[model samples]
Target: MGADPTAIVVGLGLPSDVGTGWLDDLTDGFRDECDLVGAGVAGGDTTRCDLVVISVTALGDLGGRAPVTRSGARPGDVVAVAGRLGHAAAGLALLESGHEGLPGPDGRRRDDPRRDDPRRDGRAEPYGSDERREDGVAGLVGAHRRPRPPYPCGPQAAALGATAMLDVSDGLLQDLGHVARASGVGIALDPGAFTVTPEMERVARLLAADPLDWVLTGGEDHALAATFPAEVRLPPAWTVVGRVTGGEGVQVSGRTVGQGGWDHFRM
Candidate 1:
């Protein structure tokens, strides 16, 4: 928290680069991405490393509002999520199958590995020829590499009488599980309520993957998930995906979700 109550201080740690260009690009991205949600970098340190490893510390201000935590949810609150989900995992599928039509920074570089890969001999990428930016895959690709969080929605939900809130960094169910465990309440999710984009569906078909799995298990979407009072009218940015219920864990539809959240130590 800052003296201004709305200002946040961010500290960034960057790997040392042999060339100044990568550092410059990272700095610009940090500035632009942070500013996208009204955050500013205070200061930090840089050091040499074998690969780029960035550690960021953010001190957020709640503008004098009580902090919304995982423990605030209640059995009668309505569950909600802001923004889309599942595209990041789909984008990973495209990149892995040589459909990596993702353009280089600022849309300058384009590589057709199908036409150039000596091993494949002109075999097209797994997903057919539409890697171009206009083909709609760009949304998934960009979101995976550079996530845009629904920053304003956090405070907005808080103001709207939300009972609990958290960022969906890990898989949705996994993060929601945290809230459920912390609040000592159970969560019931409606799979039908998730917003599945066309690109996500397309990639899911190609990979023989379930888009619902991605929506539930995919990480890095950075969407805000919260529980508001059942009677409070959520703002336009919020989507009620489920409800708080009596139980000790999360259940989607009628099935209990196993302990499937991300764990770095276990992985």
Candidate 2:
């Protein structure tokens, strides 16, 4: 749990025309991350490929503590999340739908000089514009373009007796399902436990979608979701949302989720 990070072997695939900007960004990004986690750059390689791909292999020294793995979760463990969920999915939706004028930092439509913006007058103005991707509204697009995961939280959770842990690189329910399957347990998720940010609600209204669905199934936020013993007092970094039980698979609000999350093999 108190592992000191070692080298990071990164493999980059990209189009030659795209140049070194991505590589530079990757270098700087990994440097920042390594610095935060007490790691150093070892070496890496770059190659031209059809699409940009980054494979980061992180090696570390655990300082003699056993690794916290998914299989350790027990029936009585409490499920928790380290931070707000569903932000990345909402941001991607905005980008995919070409939504501009995204909710500002305050979760309100960015007030533009257009003056006649209907949302300003409390109307459900039609969404989908290129402007949201512009520099003016950076919150959503920023998440889509780059992720800011709480790295230090991992060690904290580990030291605090987290039984099982993983990054929310995929959707919450989808990732939790992995824990359930590996631990041979069931997870009961309470959607009401999540913090429904105004941006999620705004996106839901704009797309006529369910905010809970996004929160449960949206991916790429990189927040940590872990399981701890029932008696553990989780720090402020985490909030309880569910619990493990004797069963298989996962359920939300007492109903089985017929489908959840994304598969790289097939959408």
Model 1 TM-score is: 0.80
Candidate 1 residue-wise lDDT, 1-267, digit = tens: 011122334344444545687565666666655555556777776666676667776667667778888898999899999865777777666777766664433664446533222123222222212234324565566557655566677778888878888888888888899999999999998888888877677766777777887788778778889998899998888999999998878888767877544231121
Give the Cα lDDT of each candidate: 0.70, 0.71
**Best-performing candidate as measured by lDDT:** 2
lDDT, residue 171, model 1: 82
Residue-level lDDT tens digits of model 2 in 1-267 = 224567788888887777676556556667765665667878878898988788888887766788888888998999998854776677678777767565565667753433322223333222222124333334445555555566667777888898888888778888898888888899998878998776677777887767676678777778889999999998887899999989888888787655533322121
Q: How close is candidate 2 to the true structure, as a TM-score?
A: 0.79
TM-score of each: 0.80, 0.79
lDDT of 1 at 234: 83
